[model samples]
Target: MSKDYYKVLGVEKTATADEIKRAFLKLAHQYHPDKNGGKDDKFKEINEAYQVLGNAEKRKQFDQFGANFNGAGGFGGGQGYGGFGGFQNGGMNINMDDLGDLGEMFGGLGDIFGFGSARGGQGRRREPQRGSDIEAAMTIDFLEAVFGAEKEVTLKKKITCAHCGGTGAEPGAKIEECPTCKGHGRVRRVQQTILGSIQTEASCPSCGGEGKIASKKCSECNGAGTAYDTAKFKVRIPAGVDDGGRIRIPGYGEAGDRGAGVGDLYLNIRVRPSDKFARDEYDILTKKEISFTQAALGDKIEIETVHGKVELKIPEGTQSGTVFKLKNKGVPHTSGRNIGDHLIEVVVKTPKNLNKRQKESLKELGI
Candidate 1:
């Protein structure tokens, strides 16, 4: 039976040339043998269909003869349309136009497949690269972490060149196209594959992807597009941030090469412990000692909190390990929206070594 190229490429007979090309490209990307879940037979079948339908004259002849037409036009003298027996006898003929598109298709996927260089180990392009990220350790007092503070940090790293504005060109230098790639930023090479002779493209190794070079190098950065210097910036620490917390400062990291973006700076915060208070989440816990007289008679006493010293009422007959809450006396929220409470634990101190006269007076009152 004659093959239907239109059904093979999944396009209508009235489909335009661009539509047919798009369908072929899409299917080829899906069934490329190198990709996962791709079948070799399916890939060859799609390519064979495109070989006929992709050509105008062949498509017209196919439309006239219909799917059952196996005569002898494009399929090599009565070999029939459905017979791929030509595979054993070298039937992998690809069009030059499709070859260029295929090269472009593979060229854009260099990063994905890590296709560094071409055949014979050709050098790869110097692609634009980002700067390295920075991490710094910071130690702050407990109060500072609770209330937040701004601190200055100093770092020594590469910074953007002040001269020539990171273009790597001197005050008066001529910028010219890359000699290697001829300003195309990419170079094409032909290779023989299982699919037969094919052309593929890669980034220009000499000039990178910019395809441009400077005649004179910058004096300040020496053509590196960046310089080394000490930089200092203030970092804002938010409130209620616990120990082992992390703060991110964006774009403050090392500068990228060839005028790319900068990286980030991460601050690892370590909060010092307080002597008088302990913390649980956002709440502050403190222990206070009260005399037995004060606990029995119900007296007001000063208690220490993260916020400040506050008055706490000791209720009558209060026992040891009794807890009291002071609202809004703990840590403040990072957003300043709300505050936590301060938990106060009371410890009663019993009077000891009473006088004998005082003991006898208590016995007489009981008699």
Candidate 2:
């Protein structure tokens, strides 16, 4: 038996168009494959129900036929009703002329059918599809991260083909109806279940469910509609971007197929190990070594900061483990208004070797 479209979308048969759409959107967001742990089947079900109920003509037909009409050909041999179009024993066929007008229709249908479709007309079919957000890891020098820097990275990804303009067909070639789908682009298969026969619809494999075939394939893309390309992108690392911090670069990811809008890129930054410095959110920490004599007598020492080297004065009788703060020398705030500070930790070093004259002088002074 055919599933009840109203029940699938959790709406009444007399529900308004807006109501149907709201229910579908709610369910679709919940069951989306990316977020829903591989629940593609649920997503497909929700999309299919919406396709039938969302349209006035299709809903009328479904309400009247209750899966009995099966459109023009019946279960396995007729054209689908109300724009359902292609259904054949072997496969479905699609007409290229119909492709331009079916974007909204097919997009909604794809939601039901577990696929996605592009929008627009031939030669101008691209839409402003939201770019997919991307995530990547980057490592920078600790000092560079504190001060901020621009980095160039190479990424390999699938991009729309320039040769055929992402149509997968040669320029000036004609499109023909698919013999398999007979211009419907779909097929029905009946299975014997415990409750008797159950019919299911699937995309036509021969024409890849577009229901049309190209007479000549594009040479550059090999009829795949997309090609692999290497891209170089410039990413900006902010001063305060620490380990595990994320940076968003708008529209710098894989291009959508067939002139669809580009996706965004995200960078997950990881600071490289530093030999001389460590970092907190916006503060830099470094250990400074001082001789025991210098610690007792006090001295001027040069310390490295994210900006440059600065002189730090140690007070007389300073302790071995004293810390000094250098103002406005650490990472810049993301707000771009102020900078952080640098912390210097003092460590007194004892002499490892002593000369005979040094030893004799020390004995004369002490003993």
Candidate 3:
């Protein structure tokens, strides 16, 4: 074999399952492509090693045959077969469309174990699918985001048809078993490919895989069980949620096809700029201007914070651009446990015009 999985993970062959898992996790964190300075090649190598060695049954086979084990009883007698000999079995007909979904793992000489139908327009239906998730951008004021607020949002999307009650059948319509696939929801098809003729089971086209048909379709949704409608609801914006943050509201997205399941609605936050305040994460930033005398002589002044107004003491000889932190005065954390500090930047304003007497006051003290 070209690579050793145990050596790649820096673990012994005799390592326990927990040890293998820990080693994989540690290396995965260090080389994950999402992290800074991460190496993609190394990450892929680590993942490949773990895929075989991490499984109990696969590991047992790997221990016996090393990395080159490929089912087929280890040696290619009646075992591995030539290129497409495995397809000789009546149960192993390949679906050419789903072949792309298999990717490099099973591209050339491998066969999918059992009944397999990858996603497609006429593919076999295994289970009821959930509706598609929807995302929308929501703009809120800075203060409204700092402190949670309730706002209304108008959404235009698919909803269950009121007339049909999501059944795709009009009230009092006669429902009968589909005649095309004999109520099986699927039918067999033989297609000619480059490899040869491949037979696959597909969803019945007449009934759209429902296994039943309505004598009279719903007029509102045209028998699809869903219709486009407008809905308005109030959403609670969480406190301390930063701009570009996403909030998920469950069961608010488009209704699922044929009433299968609903999806979630995601609101992407966009905070409007504030003229009197700025933000650095959870901290609230505000600038306060004071006269030169207050900076030199010291004074107690009121500062406005997100919570409310509070008094702050400026020490004597305080310089311009000095920032004071007010503990627990900034925005509340989304968790509601921790509160951030309010940062106040003091800007000292110098007197521009001075009278002769005012200027001479400094000279009189010297004279």
Candidate 4:
């Protein structure tokens, strides 16, 4: 009897490829045998369903003739779907592109199943490899964070050697073809597996995928092809960038091997706290000390804001924690579209030390 893969994965027959994949991952996580209470048989069943429905061509055949169409018997003897036959002859061909980073879900079973991870195949030559990313931290003043500033940061890192120009060879050395891969930059090996003899290609270890090697090594860098050097980068800090914000400087990371694509530099921003102002997202908060008489009399006073000093009116009978808003006096947005407001929290100061005349006057007024 044909098994309904859609029912097994808890999906409709009309489910899209992405929908099928999502269902498979969810069930795979639950039934994975490595878990504390994993169902090995259920995991295998889910994998089988995904193998058919996850693939476009296989799904088409399965939809037309039922899931049993691709079974060992096949649909009325139409070559038996050749499902594991390819594995029996050549090897199992797994598409690493579709797997993406989801291969991590398999975890300990990665080696057993030969899953290509984020680094892809171990032996395959990484054509145009991406460089390694570098992380750094920068501390800026509160006002600088509110307004934006450009600052330079220096770092000591590996750079291409000036002597050999990253070739790792002497100026006049003889370059020979890689003997390991025969100038192909890759070597193929056949391994016996449960499926059959699987052929795999890996980068040439001798030449490091360059297909060539130098007879004499570079003297200055000692054949490392790189040297320790200092580099300075000017980074632009955006306005209203909060603490722990990251700034990415593209192509400023470590140099790639043999002129491959350069990686990026990530700058973690650390904003220092202001003595007079506190920020809440885009809004600026400040505290103003007012005399008790001023709160009762309603007087105009000057308050310092990020933009400048502005006059704020204290209303009559104001409470101790009265709050006032100053429109457009806060930080300007990084997008330059809108600005935030400045909020002032009033703290009234009460007279504690009283002279004889002041106490007598207050007593008279109260009476």
Top-scoring candidate (lDDT): 4
Give the per-residue lDDT of model 3 (tens digit) for 29-113: 6676666777877876676566656667657766787656553223334543332222222122444334334423333211221
Model 1, 219-264: lDDT tens digits are 8776667788898889889999889998888998888766778889
lDDT, candidates in the order shown:
0.74, 0.68, 0.73, 0.75
Q: Write candidate 4's Cα lDDT for 296-324 as tens digits.
A: 88899999998889999898889899889
**What order do candidates take by lDDT, descending?**
4, 1, 3, 2
Model 4 alpha-carbon drift over 4 Å, by segment? 1-70, 73-90, 95-129, 163-189, 193-225, 334-337, 351-364
Q: Which is superior by TM-score, 3 or 4?
A: 4
Candidate 2 residues 43-129, lDDT tens each? 766766765677787788788988564432233324345243321122222232232234244344233322232222234223224
Error of 3 at 241 (Å): 2.5
Show where candidate 2 strays beyond 4 Å: 1-136, 167-169, 172-217, 222-224, 350-367
Give me the displacement of residue 38 in model 3, in angstroms.
28
Instruction: Report the poorest 10 consecutive residues by lDDT, candidate 1.
Output: 111-120
Best by TM-score: 4
lDDT of 2: 0.68
Against the true structure, what is each candidate's TM-score? Answer: 0.65, 0.52, 0.65, 0.69
